[model samples]
Target: MKQKMLAKAVGIALVMAPLASQAAVENIQYFGYAKWGNIYTDNDDHNNGKGERNDVIRASEGYGNYRLGNELNWWEAGLKADVWQDGDAYFDTTLYLGSGESWGDVSIIQMWSAGHGLFASQPNAKVWAGERFYRRHEVHMIDIKYWDTSSTGIGIEDWDLGFGSGHIAWMAPNSSADGRSLHNIDARISDIAISDTADLTFGLNYIFTQNSSYEESDITTSGAMLSALYRQAWDYGSNTFAFQYGTNALAGGLMSAEGGSNRKYSTGVEHDGYSWRVFNSGDLNVNEDFQVMYSIAYQDKNLDNNDGEKWFSVGARPQYSWTDYMATALEVGYETVEAQNGAGTNDMYKVTVAQMFQAGKGVWARPSLRIFATYSEKNDEWNRGGDTYGTAMRNASGKDSVDEVTFGFNVETWW
Candidate 1:
């Protein structure tokens, strides 16, 4: 259905091309990103073909773990174009589609339009309606987006404040917000130059209660969140440190701080709870042949009902470029999680090494092909029966061992 809808959009655009030309409309080029890959366990009897991670038991909750060998197939692509530009006034629009493990599982992820140039004092100011992936941040190696407010609604962006630029948005709950009809407001300020070598960003989000309180039939609740990041740059690399806090229905382990409307529903419960996180990540270019990325993150979540979780993780991936288009990398990552008031703890460790063929020289180069091997192990607590992953996480022994070796190949590129 989504594919068919996009097809109709293209047809309508072609039919209106002549009228668009007369209206000063300009067509922008296409843009997209994609990563296609798979992994298989080496256990002869199991015949497993999935990416494994220590983060799996938590169902990939708060902070994510190492991504290289722990990722499956996924991709998203989109287009942007100018509707019309008449001197100080203009309009623009964007649309995109995303697919999950299977390409057939595709959906329209972004469809929005904006108008600009109306505010002469702030020529960069823009008012937009529809949906957009606005103001998102992620730790690449861990594949965790600590800050995100992407949703389907209306917003104003790029306001020039004296200290920094500012953004504000309203996300509706019709087909978004997991079908909850609550008022959601998100606001943030960024690009604040704290020093010659540092900058900062801070965001606030709120969700108003509509159904009074939580009942069997009513899942709506009031919530609030605050998030901030401090960024610094040096000659070889840059680093970003983040802190996030959320309360009640708007947070869980430092997320939903973005207001949770982008996904089908909140990844966490809608109970009265509090969540917070402290995290840091950086990418360094040691030399022409060696590059490394590292991160450390910790998050805590607790609910009034006495059920919650805590997560701590650290990982690094270092690559060496042998030539202009070839390199090798080893990724080592470790993670641990504790039930707020339940069990002791569980820990996981993983390591992977991949040989790569790429497009350019730097460690951050694009369009790379990687052939890799990985080893991962988990504590006995997770290996016990009746775990979240069940037998899928089991090893050949399947009795009390929770470890596996995997190998795979992937083609990853973005623009």
Candidate 2:
């Protein structure tokens, strides 16, 4: 009797498979963005002290992405694909067909399989593997990924946890010889009531690395990182505050060059120390036609006995819209860096004004064409003696400060 029942169920499923396939929707999409422009400055001869030309204003470097993907579904397999390139080489290189040379190599930034319904308890969960862009958050104006832990990894995302959700991922270096692998776990809780009109969210992330030897020193190393975030939301917009602390080997993740040998003070060595950063971002809308976005970040790191370094940056972008398609924007940014042991301090300032044409009414709307003018100033202590601007100017004219103005028009869009 049980065998008969099982056979009957299998026959019914085969008969319904065609009907179910017809009712299921399959989707594919391609999306990308492009930006280009020219910049001209009043003076183009400034150099850092080195012989290299350190022009204050030059042509803008551009970046682009080409992505194609299918919609994720529980019962069907899908593919996520991407090709990306950045920097001036993409514009300056010459094309060659069969000479074993090309303009530039296009990189596969991400190519992965993604789908949902991996677990019955977490029906909304998304499971994926292969090279991909993991969770990364950034400060828009400065292009700083304050919470960047992106890597080639496998992970499950949006796992329901009653009150919120969780994600777990494991990432490894492309080559086993580079370093040991690492695992990351992140949890986010949302909609904690702050008031009738406000809500709060909290997030925690942790990373741990396996033991590995550093190629330069041949010393075994391992490390960990912990990060926390808090956010508050209201009718107009939201604000986010975040902090991260890590050991020297894991400050910016085991694969990050920023905290290891590539750090400014640590040239080809890693030591026992600590690193931390504090960051905040705010988006506020004053009215239908006006809005503001601002971000501030501070980071400090100490390695062994080396003089620790401190960095601070703050920037703001404000815009006023006259209509859905027209708006004016002004942006100002400043950054300063110093050594804790009084090695030196450097600072720079930049300002930009732009008249923009966009398809939408908000400050965050994309697909924009902008006519812009930018002004920038650098102090004597800010990369002054290096090869580009400071050394070039001092060598040429003995100038202590460098100022520049750039004007250009550029268009950016995505679909």
Query: 1-415, model 1: which lDDT tens digit per residue?
Result: 8887677657656744553465555777577888887777755435343333212221222246587766757798877778788898998878777886765676778888899998889999999998777677888887777766567779888999989999989976432334556566889899999899899999988866444544554343567888889999998999999998887765552232211224222322335677788889999989888889899988787766554567788988999999999999899998876666554456778899999999987668889899999888766432224322112233334334467787888888887
Those runs of model 1 whose alpha carbons end farther than 4 Å from true positions after fitting are 1-24, 43-63, 173-178, 209-220, 253-270, 380-400
Cand. 2 TM to true fold: 0.68
| Index of the highest-TM-score prediction | 1
lDDT of each: 0.71, 0.52
Our tally of clashes for model 2 stands at 12
Clashes of each: 0, 12
TM-score of each: 0.84, 0.68
Q: In model 2, where do residues sit more than 4 Å from their true spots? A: 1-25, 46-105, 174-211, 214-220, 252-268, 380-400
What lDDT tens digits, residue by residue, belong to model 2 across residues 130-225? Answer: 665566655554545565555567777777766656677776532222334545555555545556655544555554445444566623154456
